[model samples]
Every structure is written in C-alpha cells, then in structure tokens.
Target chain A: MSDSTPSTPRGSADPFVPAELYTQVQQFYARQMGLLDDGFPDAWADTFTEDAVFQEASRLDEPLRGRDAIRDSSRARKKRLEAEEIDFRHWLGMLDVRPQADGSLHARSYALAMRTRRGGELDIFASVVCHDRLVSVEGAWQVAERDLHHDGSGRD
Target chain B: MSDSTPSTPRGSADPFVPAELYTQVQQFYARQMGLLDDGFPDAWADTFTEDAVFQEASRLDEPLRGRDAIRDSSRARKKRLEAEEIDFRHWLGMLDVRPQADGSLHARSYALAMRTRRGGELDIFASVVCHDRLVSVEGAWQVAERDLHHDGSGRD
Candidate 1:
C-alpha cells in the first residue's frame, strides 16, 4: 500500500533486495560506529529514532526518545564515552529484510563484533533483530522500532 | 512448492500453502528447538544436508560447509558452553520461511539473546538468516545451507 516494496518482491517499483536494506542500514551506522570507536559515545546515540528504545544488557531505557530527547541524549553519551577506551569493529552480514502486512519491515542481521581496549580484539557474536517502521520521510526511510535480539553465543 | 507447516497451523493444505513440504520442514524445526535445548547438539545437526554450512559466527568463513563439520563443531560448542559458569539462553524466532526457486526454503528469524556471566549480562543481539535446502528424505525435510548473520545493527 505504501509502495515500500512488493509483497512477493521480484516485481516492484521499490528496490526489493534484503541485502540492500543492510547496505542502507550500514550507512546509518557509520556515524555511530566511528564515534563509538573514538569514545564519542553521545554522538553515536544521535543515530537513534526519537522514540527509540535501546535495549542492552537487560537494561531497557529510553536513553533518548522523541526528537528533543535524542538531541540531548546524544550530547550526554558523547561526553561520557570520551573517557572509556574502546576499539569496536562490527562485521554485519547475512542480512534479511521482509515486508510485513502493515507495510512495516522485520529485519534481522548477523554480527561479528570485536572489541579492543588494551591489545587484543575479543570477538563477540550477536544477532541484532529489529522491527522497523519504515516511512517515506523526506524521500528516505528512517528508523522506527529497533527491537534488538541480544541472543547468541558470546564467543566468536 | 511444498507446505512445511505442522498440522497445528491455520492453513496447512491451502494449495497456496505448499503443505507437504511445509509440514516436513516445519515439524523438523519443531523438533529441533526442543532437542537442541535438551543438549543433543550433534543429533540436531544431523538434520542438515551433507554439504550443510552453519556459521554460528559472522566471519571470513562465510558458511560452515559440510554436515560432519557442522555436527562436530556444534558438539564441541555444546561441550564448552555446558561447562561455563554462565547463564546462557538461546532463543530462535520464526519469522517466515519461503519455498525458494530451487525448492529450498529460505527462512528468516528474529533472535534476542542474553548471557549473564560474572554478575553482568552483556546483551548481545543478532539476526539469524537461514537459507535451508529442504529435501523429502525418508518422509522428512532437512536443512542444507544456513548463513547466519552475527554483526551490525539493522535499524529502520
């Protein structure tokens, strides 16, 4: 109905490749990944949806929600992360995005993330599950609900 | 096309549902979830194609080819994990599984996992993408190629 993509893909006005969605999502993450690795924690939070709820380590908090909250939270996170040392590299793959009945999307991506602090890079494997509400806002699809799946083997 | 759902689902033989294949594949996983949780890792891996590839981690390895390798690796992993002093929960969600062009079913699942170790649970989320090759072997459907994605956040 929203012309996001076809129910059956293959034939549609929208570019309907699940892999491509990951590529677009990757672009959205560039801002945060760079900042997080550099200790600019707050800046990394800027990439979240205004009403975004970040679920991490069993502590689900609206660290930033609504347009106003996002701006303020970004600034705070950036300042806090400047002190902690971290080198995080994320290898996101095996991306799958499907169109839902309500015109929204349910996407799942595989991650092989490695974090380095002093010397060695410890591999951390995780599955990031997201339920995204996509809308044609200003001709681009932005995030809606990023329901993360903190499910997986910690060892990579 | 084949139906891979168990008889319990709403429309098991809708013609549009692909019943035979659906029942076989669906039941197999219906069995997998329980067995894997019950600690029969190798037996669980036996449901895959001989050239099966299961990459628990996103890496240069791409896909973990061969059923024997997948079985051995899964067994080894279970051995290591069962010995850890950690609270580990493996959750696999079924999103949708489609019968592919080659009759193989490509399934996408949303995964949310948490591991509590040393008084803290680092919430690691991942999106598991499975491309399964289903076959009517001895009256059942088995998996073939599974490409699990383990890194990056696929937000809206």
Candidate 2:
C-alpha cells in the first residue's frame, strides 16, 4: 500500500510516478538481492553506493557502513549459511516509491526473507519493512541507505 | 530477470516501458492479492474481468472460468484457511510486462505463497510462475486471464 501522502510532494503532479523509474528500482532490488542470496557478495555490494549505510537496529549494535563493511558482513553470512546448508530467498513487495527533489528516490517495501533447508523444509526467516534511499549512478539505481525494521522487533 | 526478449516488442521503442503503467499493474496485484489474503474474496474477485479465466493446471482438471466461479472458489479457500487457522500471503516478483498488440498486457512473475500458523510458525507453501493477460476496464487494470505453473510441476 502507498505510505506517502499529498504532503510528501512527489516529483510528479500526476497521481502516479513514471513507470520506467519504478520498474528500474524494482529490477535493481531483484538483481541486488538475487546476487546476495546467490552468494555473490561482491556483486551485491557493488549495487550499493560506496558509502552506503545499512541498519538493522535489533541485530547490530551499529549500522554497517560503506561498501567494504557491507561486503564483509555479507560474505560472513554467506559462509555461515553454507555451513548450515540453508538457502535464503528475499522477496520484496508492496513497494511505495516517492521521488525526492534532489533526484533521489525514497522507497519502502515489505521484505520477506525465506529460508529453505537442504532437506527441502522452508520457512519464513524474517519479515521486515525496508526503507531505502536510492540514487542514480551511471544511469542505474543504487541503494545509498537501507533501514530494516523487522516484524515484532519493537524497533519500528 | 526479464522473461521477455527482443523478439517481444514492448509498447515503446525504448528498452524500458512507461513507469506509470508498470506501477499501476504492480499496485493492482498488490490490492487484489491483499484483498484475497485479508478474506475479502468478493473484492478480490472484482479485480478480474467478468469473463476472466484462471488456470492452475496442476491443481484442477479444468480452468476456473468467469468471475462468479472465481469468487466462489476464493470464498471456499478462505473458509478452509480460517478453519485451519492459517494465514497465507502471496508474493509476486521478477515481473516481466509486455504490452500486447491489442492494448492488453502479457505479464509474467514469480509467485510465492507463504503460510503462517496461529502459533507464528511460517513456511513456504508453494512456488509458482504466473502468467497473466491484463486489460484496462474503466481506467483500471483487471485480470483477463491467469495461468499458473507450479515449480517442479513439469508443466511449464
């Protein structure tokens, strides 16, 4: 559902924003998330801005800062999941995208992390609200900041 | 992942489509699926054309034809889920939308159905690929036909 209101002042006067931009953002997340889930931390990290900040308030004492930090953490997580023989799939939906005045886009989406065991058992690992600040870099959208509010974490 | 190739001509000459139309289609699915998941079968069914056809080849001997039939099946499924005290959320991603020559849209997406029990236990209920033909009715998009191919069903 749309989280933005008239007070938010979208880039367009029309009720809806451009479909191409929205599609690009969606495809960006799909590729980025797919990379991370597929154990390609370097590729996934490349989708973020050099100075990206990722915050998971309930899990980490401090937000992960910069591409290096994000990549490191992602690599560690991939290794751990591999050792555990588990697979993860991140599904994002209910996106609410708003274009900012400075050319960046403020997007929020419902993120669901599903885990599947080697034995074919699957479960929802986490349900979270993802807030992202996305900017265009070389004609592609990259995440500058991502804040995750996990369900029932009481941090949202 | 875009399912369509260069052989599939989109409405525009540009590689990407109008963001407004893509956003509208996404919003339409969000609302339609949300209504069904929230137990509003009537509203969910209304999102389909009066003569809509839904095919779940693996599950049924024949396709569900017409809005009335779709509503009845949805209501029945809602009752069964209620009895089982389970919540099902349908998530769609990796959308590839192509504007057809008839002004309709041929859209394909990965669909995931997650089930959550009363005690907060959750699992991936099903993974499927969904193909849809959408038409605009009264300035809003409605499902004219939907074909679902379950993962590993050997039907795709």
True contacts kept of each: 0.00, 0.22
lDDT of 2 by residue, B5-118 (tens): 576554556455566777887866765675776567777788789999999999989999999999999878877877776667787877778888899999889988877665
| Decoy 1 TM-score against native | 0.43
iRMSD in angstroms, per model: 14.0, 7.4
- Write down the TM-score of every candidate: 0.43, 0.58
Query: A1-156, model 2: which lDDT tens digit per residue?
Result: 112212112232233456777677778888889999999999999989999999998679999999999999999999999999999999888776777789998887778988898998877777666889999999888999999966444313
- Top of the candidates by DockQ: 2
Alpha-carbon RMSD of each model? 15.5, 8.0
Report the lDDT tens digits of candidate 1 across residue range B19-89: 44433343355345434533566566766778766755555355577877777776675566556634344
- Local error of candidate 1 at residue A118 (angstroms): 6.2
**CAPRI quality band, candidate 2:** incorrect
Instruction: Report the C-alpha displacement of residue A72, candidate 2, in angstroms.
Output: 20
Q: Give the least accurate 10-residue stretch of model 1 chain A, judged by summed lDDT.
A: A5-14
**Model 2 segments more than 4 A misplaced:** A1-17, A20-91, A96-108, A114-124, A128-156, B1-16
**Model 1 misses residue A156 by how many Å?**
21
In terms of TM-score, the best-performing candidate is 2
